[model samples]
Target: MRTDFWKKTAAFGLQDDAVNILSNAADYKSQVLEQIAKAEQRIIITALYLEDDDAGREILAALHQASLTKPNLKITILVDYHRARRGRIGESKSEGNAKLYCEYNEKYNSNVKVFGVPIKAREIFGVLHLKGLVFDDILLYTGASINDVYVQQHDRYRLDRYFVLNQKGICDSIESFMNEIMLVSAATPRIDSRPIADYSEIKLAHKQLMRTLKKTKYKEPRASNKNQLSARMFLGFGRRGNDLNKLIKNLFDQTKEELVLYTPYFNFPAPLMRSLRKLLKHGKKVTIVVGDKTANDFYISPEKPFNTIGGLPYLYETILQKFLKSHNKYLEQGLLKVYIWKDNDNSFHLKGVCSDSKRHLLSGHNLNPRAWSLDIENGILLDDPNKTLEQRIEAEKVQILKHCIQINNYDELETMSDYPAPVQKILGKIKRVKGDIILKRFI
Candidate 1:
């Protein structure tokens, strides 16, 4: 009854469900391939970017092979158009993932269709940031795109959270959102066969589609008495009528006792920072698990050649150090706990928030200015009214914390002076030009 109050008051939308959290990227990839291989009806995947790497090629190959055998099986993948047409940052310019898509389509006879969804005209401003992979009646949700590092196809990996749901209602809802909103709109069909030399050529078409998608909302199915779990889907774009931004703040507002959060990036929106301070002022338990500088994807050690983006890890560390110093009182009182996740040379990219044992938000939302303002982001808010997912949630938290070390004080963080020469120099230049603020939203 108390939970129902927020559902009504804040206008939170929900659906009935059942879910299981995967431990790592390797497990996630295995489960995805297994599900796709066995799927009878349809398989739909939506992500930010499906890189043209070994893991990406392997997954694509499997889908292509399955399509040839099944004949009638529907396999579709939706990735960011701009991302597919461009090379990795600092890499030599080339045709990018689009070229690979063309080769794959030609080789497979176009059985597996990969559509490109452009949320904005270019990659910098915005792109399709949706996250989910649906195989028939099952949904595997994650922040990772199909890539070697993301899927852990090699020794190096980018750590991310994976969740699987096997409920018909939720699965159907996600499928419809892809079919009706994404596919039917401005999604570029047969992208594999096209030669996209420049995004500007299709800029107008993409803008129109972006407008249409912003007005669209996924109609969540009503929860019934027999349903085992309650969850809400939050989707946002552009700023107006952004349900996700409101819901995240509301979750923070509704926290009674303790709040735990996981984010790969240290940049928090001003409002969220204020909310965190409020939680501390009220003496509530707050735990934040973020990636250490070494675990940051942008981190380049002193041994490696420096890129401008390499300074981001140090910048984030600077932000974290500032926050910890400001909240030293809470840290001493044990009201605040900060853990930096680092598993040797592996990277970290986990993102979500949990308020007590009742409210769990499973999402790709980075909870930063960029996620709040630019990208098209979505999430599932699981309200465990009956505490049905308590054990699973605790287990997931334990696995994530396994390789992390708690920060006892602000002094423990690395200072700018201690950073590598390249990083320190780039950071100095960024500060001089006030480019750090500009980079915050894009990175």
Candidate 2:
């Protein structure tokens, strides 16, 4: 049934020679810059945020220059509306990245367009988490947003997967979805304007836009060519009808030999966790790669004062310990394997799933409760029945695991009691009030 569904679904023909999986952030940044510089027809970039840092400025400047270099070039950037309008999380509210957009607009009389997409009326409930970049005929897909660390523009970096495919159909489909659906919707407004539209003004449109994005799939695609993999695009929204979430579980159930899953956070939604437990019970090899507490983006160094958010990594660790304790039998039997990824001061932000060395899901979906029910998400699933890309995928995994260490014991991770004084205080308070249970749903 799953095989029939995939075949019947409209998909793009992805030739082997046209696909390139990047290894590191630096190369991914370079590719973005180069593609922007030379783009002839169009460029569309979508992410949660496009920070106001050195790397962000550099990329924005490149886009402006590209517009000038080619009068016919059309460039568009879309980010979370609420996120783009607010300052740093803890800072007093003020005009945030949108201020920079306005300044750039006036300075260069910019031809490039920047749109703030409000996926929800409130940022707390949900935000636009979609991620993809299309430059002309090439599509660069990743989970990393534009920032100094994400692009490795500085000494510190946030690691994530990068997959580039030179497919015109895929690029066009993404581009059109933005232009026809997102741009036309009043909920998504041009942030480069003198004054941004107030949420009160677009309240009605916001509701309608959310309904459209949640239900719409990309345009139908051309069929796969001979000896090429079949690629399907999935728009993941609400829990009840989320095809991506359903497909992810199906991928787990269909794993004949082994299942490889990667998520920086260990907080899997209940459905995925159930599927994972079933895999272990059935004697299938289940391998999971997660980041150490220190590798969490919310982690604060010992030298720094701990904030409430800093306790999140410890919270994640506590969850990991609980899971490990329950599955110690699987660990002993060698059916379950867990790898902790840690690299210096850098953080890990990779998310995807691969089954039996045949099916691969390349996506930004975090595979958590928030991603399952809150944010707007999307993914590209590549079905390689002939295992054409197996060797390449294995090589990529090898490079990723170099900085990772496998752990067999739950005792290896830090317990809540082992956390710092400030972290312990806050986490203890949350646990006492049962806030921790509510907290896991959003984080």
Candidate 2 per-residue lDDT over residues 287-353, each given as its tens digit? 9999899999999987896678888898998888999999999988889999999999999999999
lDDT to native, each model: 0.82, 0.88
* Regions of candidate 2 where Cα sits further than 4 Å from its true position: 1-5, 222-227
Clashes of 2: 0
lDDT of 1 by residue, 1-443 (tens): 14343364222333333578899989988998999799888888899888899999899999988898898889999888878888999999988898888999888894788888777666778878888898988888888888999989999889899988775666777788887777775446557886543456666766777787677666666644344356667787867767777788878867889999999999998888999999899888999999998999888878878877788889988889999999998988899999999999999999999988888888888888878888898888777777788898899999999999998889988888888777878889999999988887776
Which consecutive 10 residues in model 2 have the weakest lDDT in total?
1-10
**Superposition error at 130 for model 1 (Å):** 0.6
Error of 1 at 254 (Å): 0.8
The TM-score of predicted model 1 comes to: 0.94
TM-score between candidate 2 and the true structure: 0.97
Worst 10 residues of 1 by lDDT: 8-17
Candidate with top lDDT is 2
